[model samples]
Target: MTRKRPLKQAFALLVVLSIFMVGFRLIPFDEPRISLGNYTIEDGFQLRVIASESLLKAPVSMDFDDKGRMWVVEMIGYMPNLEGIGEEEPTGKISILEDADKDGVADHAKVFLDKLVLPRGVAHVYGGLLYIDGPKLWFVEIKNDRPGKKTLVDPVYAEGGNVEHSSNGLMMNIDNWIYNANYNFRYQLKNGKWLKEPTSARGQWGITKDNFGRLYYNNNSTNLQGDYVLPNKIIRNKYFKPSIAENKRLGANRVYPIHQTSVNRGYQSGVLDEKGFLKDVTAACGPLVYRGGIFPESYNQNAFVCVPEANLIKRNVLHYKGLQITASQAIEGKEFIASTDEGFRPVNLFNGPDGAMYVVDMHRGIIQHKAYISQYLTEQLAGKKLDTLQNAGRILKVTSKTIKPNPIPDLSKASSSQLVALLSHSNGWLRDRAQQLLIQKKDRSVIHQLIKLTSLTNSFSTAIHALYVLDGLNALSFESLSALVNQSKNPETIAHAVGLLERFSARQHVAKMKAISTQLLAQNNETIDLYLSMSLSPWLNLSEATFLPVLSEIEKKHASQGIFQEAITSGLGGKEEVYLTSMNPTDLLKKDLTTAITNRQKKELNPIFVLEKNSVDNRTKGLKLFRSICATCHGADGKGIQDLAPPLKGSEYIDGSMKRLASIILHGVSGPIHVNGKLYQLNNEMPALINNKEISDQDIADIIRFTQNAFAKAGKGISADDVKKMRDKKPSGSGIFTEKQLLESDFEK
Candidate 1:
C-alpha cells in the first residue's frame, strides 16, 4: 500500500464525519409526519401523540411539572453523528412542551437547555427541572415563557463512558428521597443541605415504587430487582448492587449485553446468535409501577417495561413474598403494546399527569451505533431496510378508550393545606409534586394538619406521605412518630418510623420503637423486626440490656427475627465477660455463637442420648414420629395445615441455618411467625417435644433428618451430633420458643 500521509488520513476522517452529520440532519421525516396513526396498540387503549418531529428529536426520557408542562430529554447526539464520530459530543437537549391553549397535543415548544451531552434522566424538582447530563447532575431554574437558568447541581454520576446504559429513572420517592438506578448515590436536599447516603445500585436503568412505598428497580438485560423491605433500607446497609440478589424472571437469554449502540464501544456484539435475541431480555428498560388514575383499577400499581428489542411494552403482575419479588405476565399471548414498524423503538416508559402511561420512541433507522457494528446485525438491518429514519421521534400516551383522563392538577398556587390534601391524591405525579412543593416551602404552618392527615387518613399511601412531608420540614416531633406507629398497621410505615428513630438515636425514641416493635413482633411482622435490627446493629450504642425482653422472646426462632443471638450468647459467657465487653462489644462478638453454644450445651441438656448403632432408619422412624406428633400442626407433608400450624416445607429455616431448625424441633416454638412470606397467629402453639423424656436427642435428629428429606427437597440430612450440639441449650420452662432463639443458635454460621 502507498504510505498515506498522517495529515491526509486525518483530513479523510474529518471529511467522512462532516458528510455523516450532514446526512443525519438532512434525512427526511416522512410527509404528513409520523403520528399516533402510525402505530397499533393493545385493546382497551388508544395511542395519542403528544409531541413529535421538530418538537422532539430522539426523545429518550420525560417528566412533567406542577403546571402540567411536559419536559422531554432528547439525545440528538445518540449513535454519534449517525455512527461516524466519537461518543461524548455535547449534543443532548431538554425541550419544554406545553398545550398553552389547553389542547390535548403540545402546541408550544422551547429548547430549555441544549448543551447536554447524553443527558439521560429528568425529573421535576422544587418547581424546577433536574436532569442527569453525563456524570454530573444539573438543575435548571425555569419561569414560564423564558429560557431556564441551568446550574451545576450534585456531582453524582461523573458522566462519561457508554451513554446508552448509564444512571436513569430519576425520581423522588414517597420517603422524600431522590434516586437514580445504576448509581449508588442517594440525595436528600433539605433547605439546600444535601444529606447524601451511599446506596446499592438498584439496576442498570429504571426505578419505581408501589402504593406501600417499597421501591422496585430494573435494567436493560435483567428483569427486575427490588421490592425493598423498606423505603431505603438497602441504602443504609450497602448490600444492593447492579446485579441484585433478587431478580424477576423475564423470558430473556442470559448474555452479557446486547447493544453497543453508542460510540462508547466497551460491550461486545458477536455474542449474539444468528436469530438475534437479547438472550434473557431483548432490553428490558423503563420499568413503571402504574400508580395512575386513567387506567382501570385492575392496572393500578402494575409494572410496565419497554422491551425495545421485541418492539413492545410489557405489563408485569408483581407478587411480593415478604421482601422477595415474584412477577408474572399480566397480559397473555401479547405485550401491553407492540408494533410492526421496524423503527419503533420504545426506549423509556413513564406514567404521566392524566393517569396514562407514556412511551418514548427514539424512532431511528439505525439504532445500533457504528463502533461495535457486526456483519450479522448489518445484514439484519439491511433486510429490514432500517438504516436511518433519523429525524422521527414521539412521546405517545396509552390510556383507556372509555375512561377520560383526570384533569391535571394546578398546584402552583395551592395553599399548604391544599397541597397536603394532594398528598392523598390517586396520581403518583401529583403526590410527588405535592411533597416536593411542601418541602420547598417548608411551611411550618401545616405541621399540625399534616400530622392529622397522617393519623386520620384512610389511605395508607396518604398517611405515609403526610409523615414524610412532616419529616422534610424538620417538623416531625415525638408526637408525629407516636402517631405513625399507633395509627398504621402497614409494615412499610413502621419501617420508616424505626429508621427515623435509629437515625435520631434518642433514648426516649428508641424506647418508643422498642415498645412498638414488641407488639409487632408478637404478630410475626418481619418488616418491623428487620428494620429494628438494622437500626440497632451499629454498635452496643444502645445498651444491649434494654431489649432483653424482646430479645428473650425471639431467641428461639431465627436470628433474622431481630434478636442478635451471637451477641447474646457471647455476652452470656459469664458476668465478667459481659461486664468487660459492654465497653468493647465488638471484641466479644468475635467469640462465635457456635463456641458459646458448645460451652452452654455441656452445662444444659440433661440425660442426652448418644446415638446408638441400632437407632432405627431415620427416614422411616422419623416419618412415623412425624405422623403421630407434627402431622396435626405442620401437616402430613410438612406443608403446614392452616392458621393453626405453619409449614416446614420450603422454609429457609429448614434448608438454611440447620442449627436454627434443629433447635426449634428440640425446644418447640411460640409467638407469631413468618414462613415463606405468610404470617401465622399460632392459636394452637407448637408444643415442646423435648420433655427430656418424650423426645431424645437421637430421636430429634432422626425426625429432623426425615423432615428435611421429606419436605425440603434441597435439604442436606441432619446428623445425630448436629441435633445434640444445638440441644445444648435447655428449653424455656413454659410456653414455646420464639423465632429469635432458633436463629441465635448460630446454625447459619
Candidate 2:
C-alpha cells in the first residue's frame, strides 16, 4: 500500500533521548535541508547525481524496477538514536524515484513502504522489493508499477551482535539463488514449499559471485575472501567463524591507501597499517562483480568493492593459477572512484541497466556505529560534521562513453515468448527477472519453449537460467537436467544441475538419477561427487563401488570440509570396507584411485590451482588425525572438556609463535596452565598426540593451522617448516612441560 505521510515525517523524528541507542540526534529543524554533493570523477568516466540529496535521504540500497525506475531504501531513522533504534516507528522508508525527463537527476519521489526499522538491504525481485529490516525479512509487492501490500516472508535473526554486521546484502545470483549476508537460515517460497539452506553461524554483510559462481564477500573488517580453491562439493558451512586475523588480509594485488576525502573520521583502516603496509580491509561493503553489457569488455568480470571509510571504490582484477584464486589491484596507486566528499558514504553498489555503476550514498554525519566508534572518528565528527544533513542521501551513476542505459521495460503484461527472449539478454539482471516472471506465470504453454531455450541457447549462463526457471516452477525433469549436463562444457552447470535435480530424488526417481550420477562419477568435482553419492545412494541400488571415487575424495579433503565425516559417524555402515550409509565409499576404492586422483588433480587443473587444492587434502588428513587423537581431550568443539583438559579457545599461550604452539601439540602441555588469564589443572597430565613415524610434518602443520582457523582466531597460517622447527628444537617426549618452562622460553619473546 502507498504511504501518504507528509515530507515532515522524515524531518520530525529528531527528538533526543538519554538512551544509548542513538549515537547522534537530528539537528533542530523547521524546513527540509539538502546537501548536494560535488559529483566528481577521474578520466574516462562520467558521474551524475541521479537523485541528489534532496529526494533521497539515507539511501543505503537501491534496485531498478521492471519499468527502469529506481526503488530506494531510506534508513531515515537509522543511527539517529544511541541504538540506531527503529523500534516500532516510521523511522525508515522505501521510496520510488523516477527520472521522468530522461535526465540524470530524478524529478519525482514517493513513499513506498514507510515506518521501517534499520532497513539495510533491498532488491527488486520476484514481484516486489525484498528487504531485511533487522529481525524481519519482507517482500513488498509492486503492482502496476507501485508498491503494494507487504508480507513477512521470514524473520532475519540479525537483531543483536552488531547489527551492522547482520544480514545486509540481498542479491539474486544468476543460478536463481537469492543469497544474503550473515543470516545462515533463510526461507524462500518455491513450488508451494519453503526451501531452506541454513548454516551454523554467520558470514559477511555483503555477498556477490563471479561469473563461475565463486562467491566474494567482506565483513565490517575482513577484506576480500571466498573460495581460493574450488570449494567443498556439498553444503558445508554449519557456522561462520569470523576471521579476526590481522594477518590473513587478502585483497586485490595492488595495495592502495584511502583516496582523497574531507570528512576523515574512522581509525587507520584495517586494510593498511601504520607503515603504509597492508594489514586488512575494514568497512568493506557493496561487493560487486561487474556483469553488465555497457562497460568496456576488458572490465567484464572485474570486482568493485566499496570501502566507505576510505571514500573510494576498489577495482580488483581476477586471476587464476591452476585453480587457486587471486584478486589484485586493477590500478597501481588510485581507486576506481575516489572522492573528496567525506560525507559521501557509499554503502552499496549495483550494476544498473545503462551499463553503469550505481553508488548508494548515505551522505550523513556519521557512518560508523556507536560501539565501533573509534577515537579518530569521534574527533573528526566533532570538527567536520554534517549535523544539518543527517537526513541527506544520494544515488550516483558512473558511466563511460560506450555505455548508455535504455528506457525501462514494462514486463508486467509481457507475453510468455517475449519474456523467454530475455534469457539471452546481456544484462544478468534482465535474464534473472525474466526467468523469475516466467516461473511466477507458471503457464504450461511456455514449458516446451522454456525447455527449447535451454537446448537452443548457445550461452551457458542463458541455458542455466532456463534450467533453473523450470526448477523454480517445479517443472524440471530428468531429461532436461540430463540434456544440460550433456550439452554444457562448464563444470558449474553439472553442479547447478545436481542441486536442481535432487528435488526429484524425494519422488524416488532412483534409476533416472542413478544414471546421471554414474556419468558424473567420471567428472571428479568433490562437491558434485559428494552430492550425487548422498542423493543417489539413498535411493538407487548402486554398489559401494559407485561411491568409491567420492569417498576417496572425501577422505583426502580437509577435516573442516563437509558433512561426509559426520555422515560416516551417523549413517555409514560396513564390516571392513566402510561407507556412509547405502552409498558410502569403500576403503579399497580409496586406495585404488587415491594416488591417481591426486596426481591428475594437480596436473589437469589450472597450473596455478595446485597449491590451494593440495592444502585441502593436507587439512583434511589433519582433521582425521585430530579426531583420532586431540578431539578426545581438547573436545570436539575446542572449548575443552571439564577438568580433563583446559579450553583451547582464547588461549594466549597458543597465540605465541608456531614453534611453541606446535611444541605443545607435539610434546603436550603439563603442570599448571593459564590461558586467556585463567588457570586450570587437569587430573591427568598432557601426552604427546603425534608419533613421529606415523604423522608427517605437513600433517602436524595442517592440524595446527586448522586449530588456528577454528579456535585460535588467527589469520596467518603456519607452514610445514614451522612445525618441523618445533620437532627439531625440542624432541617429543611423554613428559609434559611446566607452565613456567613453556612461558620462559625466549623463542616467542
Q: Evaluated with TM-score, which candidate comes out highest?
A: 1
Candidate 2: which stretches are off by over 4 Å?
A: 1-43, 81-89, 143-149, 191-195, 200-202, 228-233, 236-280, 320-323, 386-389, 456-460, 506-515, 521-545, 549-577, 580-749
Task: Give the local distance difference test score of model 1.
Answer: 0.63
TM-score of 1: 0.66
> In candidate 2, what are the lDDT values of residues 1-749, reduced to their tens digit?
98765653432332222211343222222222343344445567776677765677888888787676788988776666322333335678777776543435676576677677778788777776888675777877776555678777765345544446556777776655566766555446665444555422224656666655556676656556665322222222111111221112346433354443322222334434555433334577777877776677777777788777666677887776433456778777767776656777777888776557788888776776543443334444656654444877888777876566644577776788988888787776677778888877887687787777665534327767777788777777766777776665555556667666655554445545556656676666655544444343333224445434444455455234333443222112221134333334445333322333344445442122221111124444555566667778887556688888887667775556777777777777775788788888778887864566777778788777656544554433678877776765553354556787777765543
Model 2, residue 235: distance off in Å is 2.5
Error of 2 at 474 (Å): 2.5
- As a whole number from 0 to 100, the lDDT of residue 469 in candidate 2 is 80
| Per-model RMSD to reference | 23.2, 14.4
What does candidate 1's lDDT look like per residue over 1-749, in tens digits? 88666874455445445545654221212222354554556678898777778767888888887777778899877764332243467878888776643557765566777778878889887767778776778776776534467667666464432454456777888777887776656676566655666554466667887777666777655655564454444322221121222234533323322332221112245434454433345456778888886788777778887766656677877776765567776755556776656667787878777788888988876665432233345445655556556766788878899888888777787888899888878887777778879988879988878877765544337777877887888876665576677666676677677666555656655676566666767767756655554455422246557654454454444444212333244223333244334423333233433344444455532111111111234555665577678777776645687777887766877768666777777777886887888877877667766566877777777677666655564446667777877766655565357866555555544
